[model samples]
Target: MLQAKVAVVTGAGSGIGAAIARLFAVEGAKVVLGDLAEGGAAFAAELADDGFEVMFQRVDVTDEADVAALMQATVARFGRIDILVANAGIPERKSPIHQLDLDDWRRVIDVDLTGVALCNKFAVGAMLATGGGAIVNMASILAHVGQENSNAYSAAKAGVVNLTRSVALTYARQGVRANCVSPGYVDTPLLAQLPAAVRQAMLLRQPIGRLARPDEIAQVVAFLASERASIITGACINADGGYTAI
Candidate 1:
């Protein structure tokens, strides 16, 4: 359904971002993958070997220049950007209102909140040139609920929730659509890095008794970006495994 469309996915080195990129390519989108880590390049190479149209760039989501180049490079290579999956984000462990380190708080906010802002800033301009496009921002289940020692992460994602709504309203008449996907803990490398106890707690949050698979989250992203979701905008889809419902 995304045939001929160009999609840019941030943090595509691995995990949920990578899953989104791979799925988009399978749906016929020319994919632009970006990550601060080297994994993005390697993943793109793997896709190239498989005959998928893809490009990779090492990008710092917090950097305006990096994001601008991503947009520029995408248009340079694929002519236009029709889809943007702003999936790059970081979660901080110390988020207690009193004990949270100021620096860590800033870093989380910069990457999680500011990063999405930059992607939208540039992507919106590019999309405007083409009349409009679809944007899917990666939020977290934490955005809606609170957790001990998760203040920074929670605050930033809460910002994403409102930010997405604002952007949706801003571009509604311009043919642009903005939506958010909030996924609970997923079985990704990132989750594996968490303390065993923390990981277990994460699994228990969902009534399903297991973490989500990255590909499952990607499926929802694909639908929202496709024509099927043409009427959906400014909505937040909880991709969590019934975590939010409880």
Candidate 2:
């Protein structure tokens, strides 16, 4: 569905980002996988061995220079960018707002919120040059609701939702479409790192009594990036398995 497209997926080494990259590749997009983790190169290599058009780059989303380089590399390799998934983010430790560590808060904001800003800045520039593109920013259910002891992550994701809207409104005239996908408790490596009790608590909070699969979220992102969604923009679709429905 995305033939001839070049897609850049940040945080593509694992979890939702990795799933998105794989889906894009399966759909015929030349994929550029970016992440701070060392696993990014390995992931790309694995996909390449499978005969997919994929490349990997080590990128620190919190660094403007690194993000700029990532975009530059994508264009250098593929000539033009058609899809950008600003999916890199970090979850801060659970703590009350009043007791939150200042550095932790800043770190979360930098990676989760400012990181999106930087990616959008560079991706939109390329899209405008190419006359159009699609961008899907990864947000969370926390974007629309409060989470106890997750002040930084919740706030940063909330900013991402609004930023997605702002980008959509500003660039639709340029044929650029921007939207957000808000997922709740997706079972990814990150969630695996959490304590069992915490993970169980999150699962129980979902009316469906289960965490979403990573590919399920990927399907939503794929739809948003396809011509099938040509008329959809500035939308924040929920993939929460009914967590937000309650």
Strongest candidate by lDDT: 2
**What TM-score do all the candidates reach, one by one?**
0.98, 0.98
Clashes of 2: 0
Which pairs, if any, clash in model 2?
Answer: none
Please, what is the whole-model Cα lDDT of each candidate in the order they appear? Answer: 0.93, 0.94
1-246: candidate 2 lDDT, tens digit per residue: 999799999999999999999999999999999999999899999999999999999999889999999999999999998999999988788887789899999999999999999999999999999899999999999999887788989999999999999999999899999999999999899888888999989977989888899999999999999999999999999999988888
Q: Global lDDT for candidate 2?
A: 0.94
Error of 1 at 242 (Å): 0.4
On a 0 to 1 TM-score scale, where does candidate 1 land against the true structure? Answer: 0.98
TM-score of 2: 0.98
How badly does each model clash, as a count of residue pairs?
0, 0
